[model samples]
Target: MSERDAPDQGDAAGPPRQRPRSRAADWLRRRVGHRFPLVARLAWDDYRHEWLVSGFSVLALAAVLIPLLVLFGLKYGIITNLLDPLTENPRYREIAPITSGHYTPEWFASMSARSDVAFLVPRTRSLAASIKLLAPGSDVGRIIDVELIPSGDGDPALEAADDEDIGSPEGHGEVVLSASAAEKLGVGPGGRVEGVVTRTRQDRLETVRLPLAVAGVAPPTAFTRDGVFVSHDLLVAVEDFLDGRAVPELDWEGSAPRPADRAFAGFRMYARELGDVAGLRAELLRQNVDVRTSIADISLVQTLDRNLGIVYWIIAAISIVGYCMSFATSVWANVDRKRREFSVLRLTGFRTGDIVWFPILQAAFTALLAWLLAALVFFAVQGLLNALFAPTIGGGEPVARLRAWHLGAALLLTTAAAIAAALVGGRRVAQLEPSIGLRDN
Candidate 1:
């Protein structure tokens, strides 16, 4: 500035020339428009490029996860097997009175209305509860005395063992025989039998015969003794005839007429579920009603379940914390290494929020892949353990088992932990300044 040297008007008066804006920013604004999709794509590409690091992270995660899965599988399988027998069979749910007590109709009604009470029926004394039975038209004098118990709809003892169409004795003339009784009387379903009640009055034996049709045969496990399940009405009639009370229903002749209000000697009660059995028994005892149940066995199974669950969860918590810290440390180091790259993005108009998502997305991918690997390993080990223990375990039951919901819960927990770990690394990324990129360059 002679022009240049002499009072350069242009340099003195003109606005200072602006440094050219970074083309990367211009391209980002024009083509990408938003930072999130670009951030996500970059995160995925970087994760794929660093295959060795990602693979190691996944392996580490799986190492912890596989053991936890296997442990839970064993716990679940064992506990489930233990509980199944008690739950599936109704016999274990029975609540039998220790001694005969006078239970009124009002008491039975209240018990029947309870949510926990599955079935409740009145019972007579053992002496009057017995009846003589013989198959009609049998050439052999095969008459057997059987215990008569009252049954109606939803009678647990009357439930069929197989897919056969067996039902409870609903009518006075219909009766269900126990396996022993059926065998002894040579009577099956659709066969006719005569039930006789004999009473001695004034040195004379009086006999009353009631014809019965066999309805069904209960399973051997339901009742081991030779017993007959009849309607409550029929049982009451037998009791009445034996008490020297007239049973007009069966045309039985006696001295005294039956009373209008009736009370029972005892009852046959069953709980709706195994868990309810203890509560039902406790309530009865509180009311001065003594009863018996398989509470010791039930309590043992429940204790095992609780103890195993506690052990599993404790191990799981420790492993989860350890793995998460390890994962977070790895992610934080990766972020420190990529400070310049993140700074470049910031300088090119990317927001702190967008850049923070980079590590998080990578963590998610790592967690998902790790879960897949762990599941595969768990199933393999499960198969081997089950096969090895098959002969000893009995019933071809597996020693290890996992359900669909279990796998789903595991996946969710793993992902949540991974995201939590990535959040730590994200905090480090948020503190990065754009000038770091210029100094590095």
Candidate 2:
């Protein structure tokens, strides 16, 4: 064959003449180009055929994971909600004397004086023995002092709970009945319940049963535990019984019971703020008041606890690595399926550079679709979880809105992974022997 007719070498002794670059080389030259939407569409069509292999592609599986994400979001929602009530508001500690023997009033007086003590709600415990309850077969149980809270700072809920509401004297030996207690006693405001409570100490027996006029009923909170609260007067009565004394004239009922007439036991103290709880405890120790809050080293112990954000970074990194692997495997499989297409392109004078871009385009489209789906799904999950659990968990806020940076970061990382996978496929095409593609085995 003439030199001009040779096929193996670059075009008829190319060094002999100055010639423009081959069409394939020229196509490979870097240039700003329009985004080829049609090229991407074609690649996506080719990639979609693998769905015939049954089971979802990685991206499809991620999209279907909405349920799992919803559950995680619920847990996150509830946990985040509880923090609002705890971190934003004040909490308290209820204290009682450690009865090495019995708490003296002096000890109570001392603990009440502490700076952290929001209120030294004096309280006493007493059992009812003499009064008969309206409920068949059950006598009245002991009356315990209801710890006074500072919340009456002018809330109508407090005003509505007058002595009649509590079913006790308006201001004196008054006490509130629990809903079940009032029902069992067959009493409303102005009605009476009589019961005897007994507390026997070595060789000492005290029976306290007084007719208690109903004042009001205690309110119920869904989260609240069972208990009852009585005015400080009833507590004083219990204290009088404990001290082996009874003033019958004062025991008489009606609203505006006299303060001097009402009785109490040894004092019980509490503080509204738990932050200085330990310090108050130490102060109580100095004052010889043995009552206190959690003094153990339990809360001091350490755990991962965000640990400088290291664990979070590790989790994020793992997620990114997983994304890359899925993206690469998906793109590679799609590229491999088009091996014959690429072979045909080479023969048609289409540069392998252009051919390799098909897989890259597929990677980009799949990531974009998955990302948009994830965004919509995540927000829906956030809303649903907040609706279901936020109020119950006692959060200050429902849900924090997702930010723009989050979407940008996800897209950037995802797009970069797709590009990386495409480049890997491109490297293979760039090095391919076109003749090998054309040869018969």
Candidate 3:
């Protein structure tokens, strides 16, 4: 047939040749049409008889890729999750170990100097340490709960709000007490808890009493129970008395960090903020004291992160190896079945490169399709697993969740590997010249 006489090919003058499509658009159309005729057309075309193998190749790839991607996604999610609860509420959850030589307000300020530390707390860990409440005997330990100051500036007491940091309290009219403290003091909303004060220059131990109105009573948190947390003024009173600025002053303190040889046991410290803990601890140890954390709490957190990491790696490794094996075998089998077709394309002037490119493209097409399907499958699997396993562990929502980024990354990497596999198999078929391949057909 004459070049201009073919159907879909018109004379240049006919409708001005339809404005001549841009080279890029024409090329794309031709490529798409050539690569994707119906299944029968692709199979019957001598040059494309092996193309069916690619459809199978993609399925194989997805079968391996999807599981691994989901696992890795879950792992990354979990590690980042560890900091969430603490970050959400910086005060109650985030606490620092006592790193200073003594549990004074100054040492508390120094240790909790970090911005991340929401609150610096000083409390006796155990309840039975000591109790000398004048006209009362409630043993106060570490203050557990911190709350919004009901009145005043809605800030912590001045002592709680640091100078630059606001870790000290806002000197308000009301005091917040623990429920246990209310029970121990034998006082209710308006009550009195008194303490002894001795003159710094005098001989006898003197006593002084302060009346504290319970602003509100809260349950015991990590800190105080049957314990009283009063206004910064009250904290000041205790501080001044202990510092010998009050009536009955215990003498002979070289410095604030000093402790009696038989000071009550159990480690504790507080800082103005969370960040300054390291510096405070180091200085205290420099002054000859050992710092220890609550070993149990630290151990629990570390264990969770480690185990999740290991589980992610193992699943990914198994999936990848299985995919490679399945894809390689499927492509090789297709190549053997179509030895005759490759022989004909060789005789028709298709170069070795063209022969190789065909299967490579086909494999890519299949991988793309399979990856999408696999992604959906992965999500389905995740849902199913959650429903099945969650019930055994008290039936709650999962801590970690998969995201689109994880699946997208998996798809790209899997497709690239599929292309590489296709190229390798295509190369072997391309080696057949017309003489060798034509002989078999």
Candidate 4:
């Protein structure tokens, strides 16, 4: 080929055509030319440039979150207060047999071995579980009959008693007195009392007086009426003596003591937690054992908690969906209006991935800022509500509250939702072509 004909190769393409750049590209180059990472700064600048729109988005999001926060705070506060007494105090977990039943040692062992059973002790019949107590140095005229409750290790009543470091009665000689019992005897902890047990055998009265030391005094919640918490052995001995069996332990005159496999009339039991009470009660009932418990009250509180939780979530779902849809639409429309600007960046060599981050960053910032605003507003409203309801809600408990975890969870959910909503606009940005800038201009 001739040299002139071969040289047409350079003229065929006519030196590379300069890529079209819009004013947005010139502005970006002037601001941050050849910067390693310009996506975040550009997004921020664009977000600031549209301050009015961004402000409205933030306020709209905050409006959605504030009411939800306040509603949830109220739910947590009111429900927690109602459930605290029943859950914290061990006394309310008590499960007592309605009528006497033959509960063997094996049965007691099985019941106590369960994970849900917090405490269990065998009890004697009502007739044999009474003791006439006389305070130390007092005459016989002051003797008062008090009900005896069998206690041992992990006794819920003793554990919940006001006295610290108080354990169950150690031996037959030691006993814990209920508030009424201690007051009636005019004694406190470390005091001594004379306990008298009587039996009518062979049409003759037999009386045995034993010295009892007071280990502690339980609060009124443990026992309302006059009662004494004694060792299981003492109650067994009293029952044996009343049954006319030889009481070698007490040295009371009677027949030979029965075998070691003797049955218990009933048992004192407690569940590990509020939820455990219902299942425990059901198990006992299935075994043909009738028992009394505060389950009705517990169930009422739990049901209220569950129902309120459902209602709260239902409302939250609706609000969250509405906010997300509205936010997505806003983000999408904003991207459509800024198509020419985004195309200018693309024409200037910014990749689709880089442009996609614009809306996402903006959305994340908006959500977080909204969350901050909502938190501030929620706390202010919480203080006002708490103060307004202080008189009705005793114990200085707040009427509206949110735990640390609750706020953290809310932040995570809202941030995630905002990002998801922005994805719609991000996809639109990704599809934009650099040629669109020229056509729009």
Candidate 5:
């Protein structure tokens, strides 16, 4: 037959079909629609027949994940408990003067005017800060030297008191003892004590005794050392006596003392919030004033939290690598055992990609079961640890807890690792030749 006139073999068969533009998408959809149910059924059959090996894979994953979750929970709980009080208490956020300076009244006024300054109190001279306390009209009198710190309105360290309790003695006569100081002096609220303040004047040290009333006792946590809190007015009185100047309220007769200046050694300042502490300190430093705050401790705690998070990620990575290796090995062995089945499926017109889904689905199911078991194990361990160690380590709080995000992350990581491992095994299964089934048949 002439080439053009002869019966065309292509025409006799049929017209050539054109492939779709999105060949990959059409192929994937066709394979998934035809084989997903078959893959699911095969996976279920494998799981039921190979229950022992499947359980082992789940247990293996749980072994690594459970301990990681527990350690993370414990560290989070312990650190939070240790830092809660320091971070929550406004008193600990105080900025105290580190060096003595002439803090004039104008300087204090300006500082107090700043929006960041919540409270401002001046400190007395250290040398002049010491005072001798004696209980009045009792053998309970014990000569004790105490530091006198400045306290006034809005002092967070001082407990709330009535107007009478906080009333000024008009001199060095009203004082609030710290809990430790009060215990040592055998005094409480509404008690009377005498103070013998000594100062140097005209190159001679002189003693001036004055009467004081104990208005209240501050809590033990208020101060790190034994001391007494007095209003700024009382502090001025104590300073006058230490300078050997006559204080009329104490009934001392001497040359009229020079008018007290507005200058102070330093001032104690409080920021409006913890977040403002660093800014306040920086501003004070720029003004050439030395300041101190608990910001250093807060920074340290935050750094530790960040480091722990890094450690957690490192641990998770290691665990995921280990689990992937384990899951891949198990799936590979199972595929090797079922090579003939995959060969038969391919011979029956199943595509390599469709056959691959069998093992992938099985791996996914295994990961799901493992994650469930791991969650159960985590909760059990959390309860056990909280019961065993909460009192000593967390002050009766839970020592371990799994936050929702943690659980979600764990599940996602495990499932992704399982799918990846299964894909690796699926590549091996896809390489099997359909001829193997025919030969075996």
Candidate 6:
């Protein structure tokens, strides 16, 4: 035969001539020439056929993850409810002296001048803190505890209001009553009450009566106690009356009197913000003053939350390990059953890498479905728990909540774990040879 018409020796001895690839063909090849789509399709088909195994995998995942999510939600909700107010409210974050010390005017001036000090309210001696309250036009009254809080501008506790006719009374006789104290005294805003201040002399205890009026009633949600909130002036008046010092308003002049040094028991000092509280407390302690803040309680709560989180993670680790084992076992069994199919695919020009994707894809599907189911269960359980216990612990607020990032993280971890578990089956597929299919056939 002619060289052009006959089979060329070069072609016969070597490889056949290849066709030039188009851009579209090259793009397709780059995109999916590895047969990932086929592998995924086959994986899905296998999963459909093995419904029982797939269902069991999903259920196993849900069984482990749902409980952890639920516990985490509960812990988050309870801790938030307990700590939110202390962190959110500037008033509760105030640092106060645990023990009474003679904080002189100079000390007060120094503390008040600090950048960290947002507000400073002086505290009276604890022994003279309690007083009897006399209701208007009634001789019989209740002996109530009084908390001398700082009032006027820059007082973090009290909200400023404009005064008008029939509005809240202000100045010397004005005092705010806690809701519980008001309820007990059967009094409200613009009410009249008298505070009876008591004192102790060298050998005997003395009593001094001071008439006062309720200016406003604090809301029930306030982090205050069953007491009245009096200004610095009223507190000083009570202190002076107890010390046997008399004013012309009360019309009594006494010879017995305490030292003239104006010393406060302690001071309630608020930081500029929550983040500044720790540093302020430390500075106060450095100055040899005993300081107390609700930040300590918040720290304790955070420590508890971290401990609980560690426990939850430990439980989750065990569950994840169990899930991996179960998934790996199932995938191994499935690979064993599909060994011939894998070998056939290998004989048909499919690579080991392509075959490896099959089990991984199926595992991913299983994980996705499981996460969805677990999320549903978690929310349902959260709703039920909140409904049952919200009023008791949360003041009608939801006691369980899950953040969006939490769900995203869980899904990502679950998918990674499932893929890791499926690697065993992928390795098994990679080990098989094309001759296996020929031999089996």
All candidates' TM-scores?
A: 0.84, 0.38, 0.50, 0.81, 0.54, 0.56
lDDT per residue (tens digit) for residues 76-180 in model 4: 999988888887677679998999999998998899899999989899999988989989664433668899999988788876534476778977799999999
lDDT score at residue 276, model 1, on the 0-100 scale:
94
lDDT of 2 at 148: 32
TM-score ranking from best to worst? 1, 4, 6, 5, 3, 2
Write model 6 residue lDDT over 1-441, tens digit each, in one string: 334454422223333666577787668657876366557778899888889988988898888889988988988898788777766565666787888888898888888898878888778786655566767654446666655555545556554222222222345678877777887778877678877766665566777666778777766544357777777766666666666676444554555445556788877677887667888888888988887787767678777878888987888898889989988988898898889998999998788888888888888999899999999999999999999999998998789988999899999999999999999989988998989999986
RMSD of each: 9.5, 15.9, 10.1, 9.0, 12.2, 10.5
On TM-score, the leading prediction is: 1
Off by over 4 Å in 2: 1-38, 48-55, 58-305, 394-396, 399-401
Each prediction's whole-model lDDT (CA): 0.88, 0.50, 0.50, 0.88, 0.77, 0.76
TM-score of 5: 0.54
Candidate 1 wrongly placed segments (more than 4 Å): 1-42, 137-141, 161-165, 255-261, 344-350, 433-440
> Of 4 and 5, which scores higher on lDDT?
4
Instruction: State the RMSD for candidate 3.
Output: 10.1
Alpha-carbon error at 293 in model 6, in Å?
Answer: 0.8
* C-alpha lDDT of residue 373 in model 2: 70
147-226, model 1: which lDDT tens digit per residue?
99899888987776665657888667999999998888877889889998899877789998888999989888778998
Candidate 1, lDDT over the whole model = 0.88
Give the lDDT of residue 390 in candidate 2: 60
lDDT against true structure, model 5? 0.77
